[model samples]
Target: MNAKPLKIGVIGCAGIAERRMLPALVADPDVEVTAIASRDGAKARQFTQRFGGDPVAGYDRLLERSDVDAVYVPLPPLLHAEWIERALRAGKHVLSEKPLAANGKDAAELVALAEDRNLTLLESFMFLTHSQHAYVCEQVVQGVIGELRTLTAEFAFPAKSADDMRYNPDTGGGALTDIGVYPIRTALMYLGSDIEVIGSWLHVDAARQVDVGGAALLGAPDGVTAHLTFGMEHAYRSQYALWGSSGRISVRWAYTPPPTHSAVIRIERQSHVEEVTLPPEDQFANVVRAFIARVRCGVPSGLEGESLLIQADLVDRVRARALIRPAR
Candidate 1:
């Protein structure tokens, strides 16, 4: 690791990067946003200028710059694997936005390629870096909720414009890909990856060419079960609940950033009830710190082959079996 700051080039001057990653990078003292790129060069220039950086015409141009040591790929889901593979082959470390790829097979290929290239490849599941999630994990282990028996998670948000990429199946748009991944990720994280998905149901929006809502039931061989749901055609709601033999833990808005949202984990023993409140912190900042640490210290982003492969396979299986119908 060098004493000088590591240089980063951002791909996809889109909503998530513009709203979250760019601001966080500019604020971090340990890293420098040296360049930005997008299919729309003007938008890339605007973002780079706004953040006091240089603009590259496209991702390939940015990757060619020897000064850029790493790249952030926040592009649409379908584009994730291709660009990630390209970045690694270009000898640049990559911090990518989640789902790793449109499916599990692609994720495995990318991971293998990055490993061969000796470059970091991480899925940006930022919530895992947040203290709130740590607090929840600690309570679960502390038996504040007793033996974990059941878990439930729900995430929903209003649909985007009719023509947005999120509504385009070609780009891997769907409620499951958008908001559902969080709950499914949480379930896998908390219950462990050995769990089996018991049953699932998905509803598609023919109008938008993606899913509008869906749910799944999962069970672990170790006596744990989870129910998860996600939707893009509903009032905004994000929540998760974990139940145990003696009590239950709940987060009001689980997935999204809520720096000040306090949650209660209720513990009920034979004749007593206890409520534990969890304070929140800046998740985006935490993710940046974690990624930089990996860049500096050479640690993998905790996204290795096994778990991500399981997640990808689960998603693929669920999508394949889902009884999808054309929009009504």
Candidate 2:
């Protein structure tokens, strides 16, 4: 017998929810988006009209729905832990957007709540669900890259809009919390969560009162090192490289590749180069499937909670250590 589709509700009608997440959820056979809610009822109604879900007046109303088996929280970082806690208390499984919380303490608290309730609470690190990353991990583990020595990643884009939430410090907005977390998490995925931040620098837009860009150097006691650079205002760049003793692996379009874009992983060793091109994948859909599998089929989330805590802690340390300079 086939398992039933998981009924889902969305807590916010953010751009990500409308552009990327809704389409991915709608395309998945294992999910049924039962409801959508936004602070603006009209926006919620419009989202439902386009996305195929019941329109709820507010988030609390959506949480009160008996038919909503799970909720996807796409709120900003500052609001993630609050609504995630509310959704869990309302007896709904949750898949929250990344940076799970503003800091490590809040993230740990939410994880504990989810554990206490036995609900599947997943942080939406959609890129990690993509096959390209899996292939890279497998190749590295099997010594295709030999013993790992260093990792370098950069994710940045120009966000010149003053109204963009990423420029608002009160909203947990900064390069470290926004784009920086990607490289930090990717480093942890390969180098383990025991890494420490040894050196850091940040550029802050004093007028905007937020971090626009920064670089961090992380080192594991075992000698593995990761260099991460991220920003919200800069030339477009999203990629990472893994440098090992024998060979090196590089991934292009590492973080935000579209569902239909082919991913290329380049391997170089001994004056020879090989390229592994992976077919398009809907990572958001994969995340939904994984969430359902864990919630309904009793599959585990595989140490994501611990990794989230580590990521949050490292973000805190980086922010604390970095020398902030006013952006010109």
Candidate 3:
């Protein structure tokens, strides 16, 4: 028999879903959007109409639905943990956006709940779903960058606005939490465990108290140093380069650039250079499909407490070290 359609609800009908998730999901043939919620009732209704889905004013209404097998929690950073826990308690799987939680403690709690309930709680690091990242990791393991010595990645996009979610301290706004997490997590994804934040610095707007941009130095267990930089006050820039004893590999437009959009992966060996074009794909769809598969086949979710804990731990440590906190 064919599997039932994966009934899904979306929270936070704001930026990321409207721009990225909605379009990607609507284009997906495997999933169904059952409901949507937003703090603004009118906006929620309007967004539901726009996206061709059911509309509810509050997220609680969506959570109450027995048809919603899974929920996509795209709320601001501070809101992730609470809603995720709620979704788990409601017996719904969750595909949450990055940073996992407002802090490590909350993230640990969410992980524990997901574990106790045997629920699928995934952090939506959609870029990691792209094949380019895996390809890069393969090259690294193959010694394309022999004895990986260094990693440098940067993500910078112009500030959307002071009122934008990225600048709202109450919503967990900061360059580190926003874009810096990408490079930092990317490093951890490839290098394995024993990652430590050696040192860090932040440049903040005097009035807003939000970090406009920042940099971090990470040390791996094997004597590799990764330098990561993120800025929301500048022009668009996203790239990563891994350097080692024998060679270096670099990816331009690493994170936001679409996989099928004709990006080049350059591998520089001591003697020659090799550039390859990566396959294109909708990574968000991949994430959704995975969630649907797990929900349908009675299969286990790949996401686990240890992984979420690691991500949360790193993000929490970075925030603490940099001394960035939400405004009162």
Candidate 4:
């Protein structure tokens, strides 16, 4: 028996929705792009024209649509808490972009609200859904990495324009919240959520009070450690490595890869080095499917809430203790 596709509404017509998410949603048989909303009618229309959804003039209007079972919120960091609350209260499941809130306290509040409402709330850390990571976990569990000791990850790319929203502090613009969260969440994935912030460093645009880039040191009580570096001011890098007692595992493209990108995991042991190439996958589509499954099953609280709070806490810690370097 076939199930009806989950009818989805997209809030905020950001570039990511146009470039990555909408295409993935329309391609998935389990998802129906029911509506797409933007303040600019023309912008919403452009997305609907390419993606096969009805254009909505405003986010509030999209949320009111009973046809939408779930919504994907890709709005700016400052706008997340407000819109997510409204969507959940409207009885819609939410899948939001990362850094779900500006801090841990706010994130916990949102989690509690969703729990009380019995709604699914998930953060979009798309990399975790890729098959390559599952394979990495398999290797670690199989002793291929020989008792994982330390993990290091870095995810950075070129900087945005001066007037970009990423540079606006009020909009939750900063390298840490934007790019740094990737490696931080990756550490929480491998090292456990109990991970603590050892120390951090940030390059701040003093006048703007925006963190341009930074690195964080995280450690678990079990002696495992993860060093993460991320920023929008550097050349491209999307990778992480796990070092163990006997061998090491490295992924050349760990974080964000296009749907057609084949992920290569390299294992180096005392005897030899091997490269495992995974078939290309679209993690964006994978996450969308996962969201649909959760919505259909009416999964209760804690399916992904605990991790969201943990990630939010770590980001706050990094920002709190960062050794700031003024942007030049």
Query: Best by lDDT, which number?
Result: 2
Computed on alpha carbons, the lDDT of every model, listed in order, comes to 0.80, 0.89, 0.80, 0.88
**Residue-level error in angstroms, candidate 1, position 300:** 4.3
Off by more than 4 A, model 4: 298-303
Candidate 3 residue 77 Cα shift, in angstroms, is 1.2
TM-score of model 4 (CA atoms):
0.96
TM-score of 3: 0.93
lDDT (0-100) at residue 17 of candidate 4? 80
- 279: Cα error in model 3, Å: 1.7
Indicate the worst ten consecutive residues by lDDT in candidate 3: 319-328
Stretch of 10 with least lDDT, candidate 2: 298-307
Which digits, one per residue and each the tens of the lDDT, describe model 4 over residues 104-200? 8989999899989988898877888898988998898899979899999999888787788788998866999888988988888788888778899
Better of 2 and 3 by lDDT: 2
| Residue clash pairs of candidate 2 | none
Q: Which ten residues in a row have the lowest lDDT in candidate 1?
A: 258-267
Which candidate do you rate higher for lDDT, 2 or 4?
2
> What is the Cα-based lDDT of residue 13 in candidate 3?
84
lDDT tens digits, residue span 168-268, model 2: 78875788887899998888888897888898999998888888999999999899999999998789999999999999999999999998999999999
Note the clash tally of each candidate.
1, 0, 1, 0
